[model samples]
Target chain A: MKNPIDNLNKVFDSRIRLGVMSVLLVNEEINFNDLKDLLQLTDGNLASHLSHLEENGFIKVRKGFIGRKTNTTYSITKAGEKAFKDHLAGLENMIKSIK
Target chain B: MRSKEESLDALQDIRKMMERSSRFISLSGWSGISAGICALLGAWFGYGVLARTGGESVSASSRTSQVGLSSMGEIQQLLLIGRLTFAAAAVSAFIFTYIRSKKNAIPMWGLTAKRLLINTMVPMIVGGLVILRMMQTGYYDLVGSCSLVFYGLALVNASKYTLNEIRYLGYAELALGLIDLWQRGYGLLFWALGFGVLHIIYGTMMWWKYERVQSK
Candidate 1:
């Protein structure tokens, strides 16, 4: 048997990343403002975590305009979804083993 | 290995986040209550029109008087009342839902809401078209029952995106519709029961379950 924690993605270590991924998993995409509102995070903090996910290719960014204002939306990539799901599976396994 | 408790907490957190993001739970129980009131009011008005048309037993005898509404004027009048009632209920529900979402700090038109609307609307739209065709073909007796059935399906379809209580309401409507199918002539009565009475009951239950507990 293998240790489940070892199989966890290191990028998911932060709670914000976990939250972002979780939100994206259920939604097709979320605009920056809406995501910020959902997470209740300050602009700088959300930006940093979002950039981190983007850097790791765990999420994709789409920049478009809603009339005059530019809107930036985020959605989980296939890799991101798989990684999050795997992380979840690992968590589930840990529970099963302990029980 | 980490303790089971720690893993459990993480799993709970994940479940919460996913559910919140995916489901539109901001719908106020008041939405149901108001919609039910509107439906009941509509039924009363419809009954009035039926009475004025010299069709005393709008609930029974008159339905068998002929295949459908006796005259185009009567159909138009009943339809107008029905449409008004539906519009009133919808608007009221939307207003209540919007206010509740605002209070809860949830986005009103998010993807979850969009999905909910789309899922519910598809069935409702199909049902609407089918019912219209029935009206044209003089199958008025079946209209009320079918509406109940279709409305039930729409709610059941959208239940995943909203409160679980609605699913039960949907089920009740579906059951009533099925029973009304064989009963015939009783379409008006069943429609009132399914749309009017059932809504009030469902709305009250929802309010008691969610709003009462939360507010108090």
Candidate 2:
């Protein structure tokens, strides 16, 4: 078997990106405020990480207006879902094989 | 290159973050609120049962001796009511909890939830036994206090597996049970306060914290 490390995606190496992917994979969509609260991260840090995931085509971002205020939401793209699952499976295999 | 331990830790962290719940608690707030309502209703029915049976001591004496149709099988009736109330509460709470878990796409009976259930059930099963024994020996006065204390212990023990909010509720239950122990003849009152009122208050807070707040 090929090394599982070789199958892992580098994007998920960062804890924040991994967290965002994990949440989006489970939830249909999560708004910016709730996501921020869940992760307990500042707006700037979360935004940068969110943008990084968006750039990799691993997540979809949507901006809309909820009444007067602008609402930003995020969800995992199809590619993201597959990539994340693969990364997680790879990590599991890596742990089992390495251990 | 990370070691095996670090990789495993990351996997665990991913699961925790994915839950959309507090680090420990997988149980939802809606369950708490509904359970409280059921408890209140049960207490009301229980109180009505006692009032109709000429109260506890009178019913106890009637149980031993031959009496008219007044006190016939009061304990059995009360026990049946208790069982039904427990069943209703459990079913309703399960429904609400299942809905929340489904919306979150979290498996209801996953390993973490199983651990929570096991931690909660241990003290509860033991308490059920103690309660049954008390009823068999006719130490009826201590029944309410025992139930409260045991339930509190169960909640506290399971707090490590669930939300920390349960710990405070457990403490409240312990305090109420002790007071009931000190002053007997008010089991139903204490039961109502502990399980009914306290559950509603705490459940609302939990719902607000986890559900309403999150929806925003």
Candidate 3:
């Protein structure tokens, strides 16, 4: 018998990363500040989680300047969307199995 | 291993965050309520103007007992009153929405809000221009219905970026506008029903559903 836990993506195991993916899935592109505000995460914590997702090729980052200030925006890749959906299915299945 | 409750809580949190990112959820119920009150007051003022103008024409031309159409000056005065009332309502609505957004720690200006504003304003602007033209050509009977229909379209257009419940209000407005069109000569009554009564009902429901819980 295969373990249901195997369906859950390892990258999405962290709540913060999951949160970042969830927000990215709904929006076309979100700036770093808006992400931070939505997730309610500290600057360093959000940056670290973003880098991890970027390294995994789940999201793409675009750095630009709005006025004199640097603005970084993030968007989800197709891979990210598929992975998040799978992970969500896994979660739903897990809940279903419990009931 | 995380417990089921923890997982469920995380799921709920994710859902909320996603919704927040895509939707302008900071619209306050008070904005709708104040707008309703303003519409009612405007309707009352408009009724008074019409009555006074009609009474004046009756008194001036005793031979023709029929109420004559208002003069250009009287019409201009009524239009000015309508514009002032609309401006007051808009400002009050903005103030209430700003306060609610601040209290909720949501940015009042953002991508979702910008989209909502653009979508809502496009229909309203078109409707305003059309109404103005209709007034110029003396098709005043259709003015109230056109305003309601266009305003309904605006709300429906903008509803995609805000709470889904707003769509119902849009539909209600559209229905009222259509009914008003069918039943002419009661434009002001339908305007009161659409803007005043409908807004108060929607605002009360929204407050009960969203804000009341938060207050507790």
Candidate 4:
């Protein structure tokens, strides 16, 4: 099995990165730590994935301060949204073909 | 500020967020506006029907017009104004949401027509019948609450196809209905809560969480 997630497979293949993108796709903006908790990834792992996505123009990273601690938030870009939606559509088509 | 690998990693994280949240975009402003219009119009027609008759005690089958200065008359007049006010607020809110959607360049009525019809018809038809029943019985007092309750039910039932916030809106209406059922005389407060205040609150939330946030 080539994995139906093949063509749909993200250009960035790490499960952690895919997971992070998936979360940002839905929420308008999510903080770094909240993403950390949701994905159960280490601080280093999450940060690496975020950097990748932001570089790809798939997401936008905003930095600000909440109280004293610096807050970093992530949101999906149009290209990112398109990629995700196409992936789902591809998966659905694959499922239909299997049936 | 970061190495090539670090930059790649950040972009990947952003992509992952986009993927996860894509399925649940915020409701089109038009949807809220359309719903508001439907609600206002429904309220108008429902309240008007009641005005032609009288109180909950009045027989539904009777066509007798009750326009005198009796208690029913006073109540009817108050409710008439309330319904009009509700219609105005909803219409204005609808306009506000619609204009915002257009301004943001979100596709208006991009929804498939068939789904839109089914979603619009179910609650509306059911609500229409309910309103008619209320009118016949002259449950004019219950008219305001009934509108809110039925409208909420519509939103809850049809929420699968559209905005999830609508379901919350329905729950709010149901709450208002229960409050109204508990106290029969305070129609104005319930109207304000259900039609006026609730819309503003829900609209603001929708705008804040989905609209004003300006997702990249």
Please list the residue runs of candidate 1 whose C-alpha ends up more than 4 Å from where it truly belongs after superposition: A1-10, A28-34, A40-45, A60-99, B1-13, B60-70
Worst 10 residues of 3 chain A by lDDT: A90-99
- Model 1, B106-132: lDDT tens digits are 778876787799999999999999999
lDDT of 2 by residue, B68-96 (tens): 36644766777787788789889988998
Worst 10 residues of 1 chain B by lDDT: B60-69
Stretches of model 4 off by over 4 angstroms after superposition: A1-99, B1-83, B112-117
Model 2 chain A scores worst on lDDT over the 10 consecutive residues at A31-40
Which prediction has more favorable lDDT, 2 or 4? 2
- Per-residue alpha-carbon lDDT of candidate 1 for residues A18-67, written as tens digits (9 for 90 to 100): 88998899888898987887777999999999999999999999999999
Please identify which of the two predictions, 2 or 4, would achieve the higher TM-score against the true structure.
2
What are the per-residue Cα lDDT tens digits for candidate 4 across B97-120?
A: 556545644433433223444775
Please tell me which predicted candidate would have the highest TM-score against the true structure: 3
**Candidate 1: Cα lDDT at A46:** 98
Ranking by TM-score: 3, 1, 2, 4
